[model samples]
Target: MDKRRVVVTGVGAVTPLGNDAETTWNNLITGVSGIGPLTRVNADDFPAKVAAEVKEFDPTDFMEKKDARKMDRFAQFAVAASIMAVKDSGLDINEENSEQVGVWIGSGIGGMETFENQYQNFLNKGYRRVSPFFVPMLIPDMAAGQVSITLGARGVNSCTVTACATGTNSIGDAFKVIQRGDALAMVTGGAEAPITNMSVAGFCANTALSTNPDPKTACRPFDADRDGFILGEGAGIVVLEELEHALARGAHIYAEIVGYGSTGDAYHITAPAPGGEGGARAMKMAINDGGLKPEEIDYINAHGTSTAYNDKFETAAIKEIFADHATRLAISSTKSMTGHLLGAAGGIEAIISVLSIKEGIIPPTINYVTSDPECDLDYVPNEARKQDVTAAMSNSLGFGGHNATIVFKKYN
Candidate 1:
């Protein structure tokens, strides 16, 4: 059977650069750096002092003060962004068709703040001092559950937890649900709030975070002399609707979700597979799913985490998958500005892909001072470029060897 068409009707994000889609897109195009000295917590003693933190965020603006107090920061961000995304979609579902609407959002590490605080309370005042809401606040599925509750969506609610690939997998799974006639509309995306002390300490212990003192140059994706990724905190949510449902309601279309592919390398826990073979398979599968030739894809929103291995391996994967078309593709790693949002990387990057299709411009991979010989692709380095993007692809490779790719196309 032929698959039903799906379209992105709405987008919402709370990023290190800015909150909301417009501001994030603007900052991304202008090559702004969201990373800075860690102000959310005392990072003076930590090895990595810089991070891409969301600024001026008030949960009260999106939720009741009392309610926001109860929820963890990740859940708060998920609920808030979902509200914005649903509003953007303009799909005012009542009790009549509410069952057709679903929610699928993900996070890599759920409620790190909650875990830290509660664990600290346990350590200080014993186990009796732990809050009753501990379990509710700390589960990875809370983001999806809370968003569903907030929107009263009852259809096919689920969460995907593939480490950094969580967000992309969630969105891609939701897309398949609509395509398979499982649901007509889905609120799908990723949220992350893992900037806690434990998270920092863990990443630092693994040497996964950048120790650069300068925020602007911390996340240098594909650049020579890159150290590691800069942790970013935020949420990105998108409203996806079945084509007929969206057209019937006259919802504005940002872009069409044409293809999605996911694979696992079964390699190391923290590193990508050698040569990114798993990632290449996912890319090829996405292209095949789109029913388009590799040459038709004009841009690639790389999962360039600014880490030495990820940049080199991802570049190799693109070369292997696209071959000569890799040379023509305007590849870029917007992580230069947004840093690594972990699970939310795929969601925001997918939004960036849609925006590129809608705006006909590609965001740059900033801080590309010296190029790596191994990464020889046209990275669209350091500056945004204007081009007619007919089709675009976004890649997300997670810890535990998970890799996912989704393809988007400009609607005719």
Candidate 2:
């Protein structure tokens, strides 16, 4: 059987920049920094003093009060974003079509706050003090599960947990599901609420997070003075529909998801492979999967985590894959503004990539200054660029050597 074409119809997000997709994209293009003083957990207790946290979010806005209570913050984010995405897509899930709809949301870390609270309760009180919802809330797959339950999507409910690449991998898998004719539409992306004490301490212990106190200038990806990534939390969700299915309903198509590539470094656990060999392969595979030449890609939403190795190695990977065309590609990391949304990074970044093709504007890598010799690509720095982006690619590299890339093309 031939593979069906897939297109992104709708997108939604709850991020440090805003509560919805458009707001986040606006902030991203305007070069706004969403990082602020870490308040979710006491800042003084940890070396990382700043974070990109979702502010003024009330779960009741998206779900019922009773249902929201049963879910952790991460699940709440997933449900909120999913509800928004489904509404945006106008894909009604009735009894006849419910089985044709699916959900695949992922998280790098799920319910860290819930785990900490439940463990403290167990230690202080007894086993009975633990809530029955603890187990469901603590697991990483619960975000996908809860979104499916809330949205009444009965087909292919699943999750992918590849650290920071969770969002991209989940979306890629969902694209495959639709291409294979298993589902007509899928609500897929990633979510995380990892601002809890344990998550902060773990990253700090590994020296993976920036110790910079000023939130405005902390996450400066590809900059010479960059320290490390800023911890962040939020969710990003998108509604992907088969081309004929979407056209039949007259749904607004954002961009066509033409290719997906996933690879593993297998060289390290926390560090990327030497010279980003795995990343270069993933990019090559994605371009080949799309049957496009390297020069056809107009923009790249890079997984520039601002960490020393990540920025340098990702630059190397781009050069290795694109060669002369690398210099012409307008690569930018929205992580500079949104911080590192961990697993949800790819989800929001994918949304941004689609928007870039649709709007003909590339979002900038804000906070970039003092360029590094190792990273000498044209990072649309500090300000958004107006360009006719025909095709865009988003890259996500996770801690466990997981590398995923998804390509989006302007729908004709």
Candidate 3:
């Protein structure tokens, strides 16, 4: 049987850069840094002093206050972004079509704030004082559940939890669902609200977050002075529909999702495989799945977390796969501006990748004053570049050695 083609119809985002997709994309291309003094949790409590936090987001703007109260922040973001995406796509989810639509969202850490608050309630005032909604709110899958309930999408509801690769894997899996004729349309992405006390403390304990005091330069991906990622929170949602289905409804298509590849390093729990061997394979697989050669890829939204090993190894992986074309490819890490959204990183980065192709502009890796020898590629540093992009690749490598890659091409 012939596989169906999938295209991104709409995108929505709640990020440190902005609340909506257009605002986020505008801020991104302007090289804005959303990293600011860590305010979600008291910065003095931890070594990491900066964070990329979504600001001035009112949940009631998207859902009822009563419904919003039952959800954690991550779920709230998912619902809000999903609503925006559905609205943007102009995909009606009426009774006739509701059963043909699905939802799949993922998260790295779900409801850290909810868990901490409820656990405190349990410790101080006994389990009886805990909110009955604690279990539902604290679980990662509630994002997908809440979105489905809110949007009335009933076909398939699922979530992927592969650490930072959650969003990438979720979108990739959703793409397959459409390709295999499981659903006509899908709402999928990743969400996270992990700037809570415990989340920060845990990352600080593991030294996985940057301790840089300055907010402007905290996350300098591919730079020699880079330390680690800046913790971030948000959600990115996209509406994906089958090609014929999208065309029948006259839905606006952003880009065609052509390929997806996922792999496990099996080398370490925290660190990526040396030289990003697994990452290399994932990239190769995605390109192969897309029926494209390495040189055909015009841009790469790198999973450059600004960490010592990630940038170096990811660079190595690209060279291993693309060789000389690696230098010609316009690569950039939006994390330098939005910080690391962890699981949501891939989702939002996927949006950026699509926008890059649609707008023919590459968002830059900001604050790249110094270059690292190990990361010697054209990083499209400091300023956005305008170029016609035919195809783009987005990558995500998670702590569990999960490597995911997705390829997108101009719809035409």
Provide the TM-score for each candidate, comma-separated: 0.99, 0.99, 0.99
Tens digits of lDDT, candidate 1, 1-412:
9899999999999999888888999999998888888977788769998998999999988878988877899889898888988898898877988999999999999999999999999999999999999999999899999888878999999989999898889999999999999999999999999999989999999999999989878889998889999999899999999999999989999999999999999889999999999999999999999899999999999999989999999999999988888898999999999989999999999999999999999999999999789988999999999999999999999999999999999986
Residue 276 of model 3 has an lDDT of 98
Instruction: Give the best candidate by lDDT.
Output: 3
lDDT of 2: 0.94
C-alpha lDDT of candidate 3 relative to the true structure: 0.96
**C-alpha lDDT values of all predictions:** 0.92, 0.94, 0.96
Clash pairs detected, candidate 2: none
Lowest lDDT block of 10, candidate 3? 38-47
Q: Give every collision pair in model 3.
A: none
Give, for candidate 1, the lowest lDDT window spanning 10 residues: 36-45
- CA deviation > 4 Å runs, candidate 1: none
For candidate 3, write residues 1-412 as lDDT tens digits. Answer: 9989999999999999999999999999999899999998888889999999999999999999999999999999999999999999999999999989999999998889999999999999998999999999999999999999999999989999999999999999999999999999999999999999999999999899999999999999999999999999999999999999999989999999999999999999899999999999999999998999999999999999999999999999999999999989999999999999988998999999999999999999999998788899999999999999999999999998999999999998
